[model samples]
Target: MLAKANRITSADDYRVIVRRGAKVAGAHTVSYLRSRESGTDARFGFIVSKKVGTAVRRNLVRRRLKAVCHEALGDGVCDVDVVVRALPSASAADWNEIRAEVLNALERRRARASIDAASQKGE
Candidate 1:
């Protein structure tokens, strides 16, 4: 489960992140990541729409995404807000696939951030 502090719950925050965050697309989900102040915890949000499936299936996908975010938090991601929007295919994707894709996207973000940091340092 995600701690309250680690979950994105405000409508405006979601709108901003979804609109302005860097996008990372996967086979089953699209993730938007935005940087926050370094002292803040990493926050996560999910959008599992009807296109994904019935309420039960949508909830299942949301739960899986949440668990993945929780696991990612344990891996030391912080100072970022990530909002994952489940694609229709996500309802059919197994947990392992979803996990792999989401993790890959997050890892890609880390790599990108590092390169950015290096570039800034070099300038």
Candidate 2:
């Protein structure tokens, strides 16, 4: 499990990410992210809805997401708030596929940040 400092704990934070932040899409999941102003560690949250399955299935999906986050963006990502939402397809996705998707999502998030920063600078 992720440490306290590396977890999103508030509904307000999650809502901000979902409503105003940019998204990174994966095959089995989607990540919404917002950059943090002061920190070097990345924080994360996972959301597996009932549409995925029962308690057992949701836990499995959460576990898979945590592993992918650790493997893909573990060290490179900076301080940010991230929420990973699982799709129904996630239940059947293998580790390799999930990892690929997570990486792709991270990359997209980075790119979006760059664009947003550039636009802010222009204004």
Top lDDT model: 1
Clashing residue pairs for model 2: none
* Model 2 per-residue lDDT tens digits across residues 1-123: 777777888998889888877787777888888788866678888889998888898898899888877765555787677899999988888878877887777877778778988999999
Candidate 1: list runs displaced more than 4 Å.
Answer: none
Q: Which window of 10 residues has the lowest lDDT sum in candidate 1?
A: 101-110
Best by TM-score: 1
Task: State each candidate's clash count.
Answer: 0, 0
TM-score of 1: 0.97
- For candidate 1, the per-residue lDDT at 97 reads 95
TM-score of each: 0.97, 0.84
Candidate 2 structure lDDT: 0.81
Hey, what RMSD does candidate 2 come out at?
2.3
Scanning candidate 2 in windows of ten residues, the lowest lDDT window is 70-79
Runs with alpha carbons beyond 4 Å of true place in candidate 2: 114-123
lDDT string, candidate 1, 15-112, tens digits: 99999999999999999999998789999999999999999999999999999999999999988999999999999999999999889888988899
